[model samples]
Target: MNGERTIYSILHILNGKKSSQTIQDIHIFQLTSLYQSFPMLSREQLEEVIQTLYKEKWLVQSLDNHYFINDTRKGELENLLKDNPLPNYLNGWKFHAITEPFWQRLSLFIQVASHLSGNSIRYIPVQRNPVTQLWLKETLHSIAIDRSNINKYLYKDLVKCLEEIEINPAILINRLTGLKKIGLTSDQAALEMKMDPSLYQLSFLAILHFMIERILSNKEDYSLLCYMIEDNKKNYTLTASTAKTYDLIQKGHNIEEIVHLRNLKQSTIEDHIIEVLLNVPAFPVHSLVSEEKMTRIKDSIEQSSSKSLKVIKQQLPDVSYFEIRVVMARYGDS
Candidate 1:
């Protein structure tokens, strides 16, 4: 943060607030994976947690009311994580929007398939999304699986895909609803597995995202799982505003043109383009900042310890802040 940002910035970052500053922070701080990692976190809950850290003297409040880690206690956070490693499959920025839809489709599909296999097809739906329900109803007739033996096929596909991953199956399995059974909620599953609810939620999301990546990689092999996302390229990768910007960019609009067409501030368009650079591979950010200037920005960032754009802007006097930001998003560490 370089201690230039306020505490609420962290709060907004964790909760995945879609503002330009919040999105820029995700890249500037090298925290892209942790974007939208805690969508369930509340303002009050985060304040309380921050208070605890303050009380423990692990985080100190600056004169400007920004939070910075106490240098002496900074190592403590890393040390604690050493004993309990983070899950390997979390790509929240890439998969956050699709996780819930994917889970809803998969869970509801399995739940319905289970009942059908057992000759009890009138069970309540575990997923209540009307869209997902509609998709399932339409998809049932289309899947190649025999209705009478869907459980066997789904189980086989699920087990085969899960076998390649490292998370305990129960983290996902215990959350499934089948026949006359109701699945455990996140808190319930966490208690049963003796894990913190936060960790359990994160782990659950990680496994789902892992499955998504695997399915996208080999859809022909994972047919049943593949059905869950058969039509799922529904723009979960970009924020709504960014998606609009992406469309305009695809039509060959420059940043100024996008701002004029969308009636948004120039800064807002720049933020969307940064998001494009981060999410859309090979979206041609090189033209936004020429190779020569991008090299200068990258060099400034590499030589400078500060993540402050203001500091870097001082060094590269010719670079626009938008140019510096795009360069940072493209070339920043992590």
Candidate 2:
């Protein structure tokens, strides 16, 4: 809460809202790494947390009614963060879509393999997704493993990856179900590791995100691990609606034409354009915005500290909000 955005905007960003404003906020605030990191964070949960902060005197309201970190408590919070910082691998904007599927697939596969190796077929599945189960069935046939060697192959690949990545494997290993063991739930694992429950869950996700990026990068080194996540391809950053808009845009349809053809509003199509530009950097910004307009917006951004659209708009009254958004989406990071 830097007073640039309301609490609702922060909530939306954590919830991974697909709104144009939220998407732009991720770039403008340099919070793309935290984008969609907490899909389970409900509005009520955020409000409760805010209330607790207020009660603890860690957050305070200004005369303008804007919420901000209390100057007196900020140092303590910063010190705590410095002592036990957030995990390294948390590119939620990029990996949020795939992390769950990757975890489900790996968890289910491990559970099934553990049962098979133990000569016991009575245990319940760790992952109950039908799609994940179907994928497991298909993958079992496709991979180079059978009942006799399931544990050996799984162990070798698992150890190889953990050793190479050099993360504390307990966060990952504790969540995995195996032959004589039922996997620990996130909270249970957290307690076992003497960590805060929230941190444990985030660490679990960070490891999964980290593993996904690593496996995809060096498929030759982690053949078995790579096979498990073959479905997690690179093209997953855009929303479904945005993907449709992206396809049509690539086909060379103008905004108005796309609006008429897709029956979407003009604003919605423009939002999709911003999303496209942010994710696909090679798309030409000049096609949608003039060089002069882009220059003005960049200048306004240089003077804008809060990254508030209203503040930026007030300074450049003639520029349409959409035009300013176009430049911010294109070169805000640059």
Candidate 3:
């Protein structure tokens, strides 16, 4: 849909409002300002465009003298006006338009597939729009049927990110889904689930429980991260100022005591310290602490009290909680 002549003027007015408007209550103020800006427009021409937009359902005026940009038309206008070398201006409508049959076909395919997961409707109020809900549901169901396609679409950087993180994809996949019961070793299952034989390099990221693992794995794969670690370590080694800062922090220095530490601001120092803690691999997921049965995992690891893998494994054998200490050890934290 083409933007009405007053589009820029209305956008400027809306931008001035600190808060967004309720759709029904925005018309006269915006329109009046737009008219004032374009004094050359005859009253008839001004009225004609507004009335025409309203008639076309692109501009909706409610019972309360309020106006709203129609959802579909607004999306079309935004796409057309988007900042790009090839803005969706010429024959873009043909490329951009969506239809029921297209979505239906995709949905049918997703449903018949077994390996795919994580398919669902996002951002739309499916409950209120029955027709749209059915269309979306069917599309998602079809996408799920073709597991590889769904995984590819959903996880665009899956393989590359996984390898970058230094995680054996086979191990991670096996961990995600317990395959031992199905007579499949985690290693075997992970290998089977590996995405795209061609582009197999996974980012250190994109793993479920290994946000920190990604950082550590990347440090090993790329030397830049190693340099960062070494540089930070050198500061601790050579700089008396750095040593004093650590001492102060260890001695419980408050913000006021730590503000004068060189060019680094107090906030920056605090952030650096927190970043260190953020990547601790003590447990792959932090939520383990809140689970009633799992609080002991931390206490057990911290004290270095000897506990067999068999004993600890019994508490939460299949869950990642049991593997937290292992992850921590891998990162040299243990």
Candidate 4:
């Protein structure tokens, strides 16, 4: 279904909840958080849809800044959702966008955080949202409130995170940590839980969402959780190709040498470099493109109406595509 209809369906679901049924107004932050899991809509696109709904009088904003479906239109929206339910699974890329790397990292981090007091496993840094460090520290402090009973607190938090899911929390914890006593892959866990792997993954994401919601609900301590989660998008890790390129670069290979070594075209290598630069903060862009060239490319890009590399290339023919991409990687958003 299209974004507008999907959003309407979500509003219907939320409003129909027994707890929220008595209070029709939904908090904007809560709505946005739930909506983020859906595919085919960026934050900007979602906001636009919301604005359109408000303009059409299908939804109204309260004095307290929460939103409510107009009583007159609520029946129509409910009927629409009844007629057409949102698809259970999004398209592959869209689904990956919503979950994947972030959820994967979070699953691993939770395993580490839960076992912190035991000191059975060492904490290894992984590419994660910067705010995760803050959350980790705060969570550790919460769990340490009573030092003698750290394991109790950890188990309590884990149970809370998995409360909504049907699987035994102990089994899920063992699977997550690959504990020697109950080592199991996700597929194995899914089988043991009598669920499909896809459904298991969704349940995992739901658990994460529950944890994040709990964190966000503690308003005074986690007031910035919303912004932190949004900004965490920037920390997406390197793709396979970019990671290979990064490895070669670390081994002191230049772009041309990398292309030769990896048997890839020069353009491909350049694309990999750009991807690495955009996603990997530690990537050394200065070594590949000089300050003087980056400035010229940035200027040309700003003056040009089109962001297409071909159009920008026409203006700066002397600059290679690699150089143009480097500059774009640095200043594209500007």
- TM-score of candidate 3 relative to the true fold: 0.17
RMSD of candidate 1 to true structure, Å? 2.4
lDDT of 3 by residue, 1-334 (tens): 1132244344333222211121101221222111112223454664576679889988876533346678779777687547322211111111112212222222232232213354432322312345545654554554323544554442333344445544445533333321111223333553566633211212111232242223334655432112211122211111234445556665766546677644567654543333222223241233322444345555444454323334455555554432443322232123
Model 3 global lDDT (CA atoms, 0 to 1): 0.36
Candidate 4, 34-125: lDDT as tens digits: 33343333546556777898899987775333466888997999898676433232222112233444354455444554455465665444
Q: Give the runs in model 2 whose Cα sits over 4 Å from its true position.
A: 62-66, 164-166, 230-233, 260-264
In model 3, where do residues sit more than 4 Å from their true spots? 1-199, 203-247, 261-263, 276-334
Better of 3 and 4 by TM-score: 4
Residue pairs whose backbone atoms clash in candidate 2: none
Error of 3 at 269 (Å): 2.4
Q: After superposition, how far is residue 286 of candidate 3 from its true place, in Å?
A: 17
Better of 1 and 4 by TM-score: 1
Worst 10 residues of 4 by lDDT: 20-29
| Model 1 lDDT tens row, 1-334 | 7577887788788788877677778877877667788887898898898889999998888866578889998788889778666777887766767777899999999999899999986777988889999999988989877898988889988988999798888899999999967899989999999997877887888898899888888898876888887455543457788989999989999888989999999878887888777766677777787889988889898999888889999998999998998887777745
* Candidates' C-alpha lDDT: 0.83, 0.82, 0.36, 0.54
Candidate with the greatest lDDT versus the true structure:
1
Better of 2 and 4 by lDDT: 2
State the displacement of the C-alpha of residue 57, model 2, in Å, after optimal TM-score superposition: 2.0
Which residue runs of candidate 4 sit more than 4 Å off their true CA positions? Answer: 1-234
The CA lDDT at 219 in model 3 is 54
